[model samples]
Target: MSYITGFLTPVKTENKERYIESARKSWPLFQGYGATAQIENWGVDVPDGKVTSFPMAVKLEDGEAVVFSWLVWPDKKTADDAWARMQEDPAMANMDMPFDGKRMMWGGFETIFQN
Candidate 1:
C-alpha cells in the first residue's frame, strides 16, 4: 500500500495563475525529497457527493471552480519526513500558498484501491 496525503482546495479566481505558478516552482522541492505530487483541476460537471460534494468546503465567496490535489509517497514514513523537510527548506519559506489554508480541506487517506 502507498501512503497518500490529499489536499483539496478552491482556488481564488483572480489568483489561479499565480497560485499554479507558485506550485510549479515548489514541485521539484517535493520530488527531490522522495515524493510525487499530482494536481487536478476539477471539472465543471463534478458531481455533488461524499467526495466531490464539498460545496461547504469551498472558500471563494462566489466561484464554482475547485482544484483537487494529492501527493503520493513511497510510504507514510517517507511522506512524513518529506513534509518535515519541506517545512524547513528556505525555498519553501515565504512562498505564497496557492489556496487559502483556512478555506481548504485536506487529509491523509489510506490507499484502498489502485490499478
Candidate 2:
C-alpha cells in the first residue's frame, strides 16, 4: 500500500494565489528527491454541525479557506526514510513556509481504497 502524509490547514483567501505559487515551486523540488506532493483548496459549504447548509468558513478578516493536501510515498518505511533525509536536506533547511504552520493540522493516513 502507498503511504500518505495529509495536511489540513486554513489559508488566507487573499494569499491563496501566492500560497499555490509557492507550492508549485516547492512540489518540483520534492519530486526531484522522489516524493510526490499534491495540494487541494477546500471551502466549507456548511458548518460542521449546522443544518441550514451555508458556507461557514469564509475568508474573513481573521479567517481563511481550508486547504487539504497530501504527499505520496511508496510505503511507510520509504516515507519515513525519505522524510528523515528531507529533514536533513539543505534545500529545506531555510525554506520559507507558504502557510502558517502553527495553525496547520496534519497527519499520515493509511490508504483504504484506490482505483
Candidate 3:
C-alpha cells in the first residue's frame, strides 16, 4: 500500500492565486523526490460545524479559505526520505508558502484499503 501525507490549512482568500503558484512551483520538488502523486483542493462549500469543523481546526480567519491536500508515495520509507531531503533542497527551502504555517495541520497515513 502507498503512504500518504494529508494537509489542511487556512489561506487568505485573496492569496489563493499565490497559494496555487507556490504549489505549482513546489510539486516538482516532491515529484523529483519520489512522490507519485499530489492533489490540492480549495474549499468550495465547506460549512462550519456546531462544535468543530475544518475552519475551526485551522483557526480560520475572515478572508481565509480552507485547503485540503495530499501526496502519495510508494511507501512510508520513501515518503520519510523524501521529506527529509525536501528540507535540504534549495528549491524547496527558497519557496514561500502562501498560507499561515502556524495554523497548518498535517499527518501521514498508511493506506489500509483502497478500491
Pick the lDDT winner.
3
1-115 per-residue lDDT for model 2 (tens digits): 6778887666777778888777776787667656765656565652543542212332223556667678887777777777788888887776666566766767777788989
Q: Which candidate's TM-score is highest?
A: 3
lDDT for each residue of candidate 1 in 36-94, tens digit (9 for 90 to 100): 66565653665556654655566445654577778888888888888888888888887
lDDT values of the candidates? 0.74, 0.67, 0.94
State in Å the error of residue 11, model 3. 0.5
Q: Name the better of 1 and 2 by lDDT.
A: 1
Task: Give per-residue lDDT, candidate 1, residue 81.
Answer: 88
Report the poorest 10 consecutive residues by lDDT, candidate 1: 55-64
The residue pairs found clashing in candidate 1 are 49-53
Question: How high a TM-score does candidate 1 get?
Answer: 0.82
Candidate 2 residue pairs that clash: none
Error of 3 at 36 (Å): 0.5
**Model 3 whole-model lDDT (C-alpha atoms):** 0.94
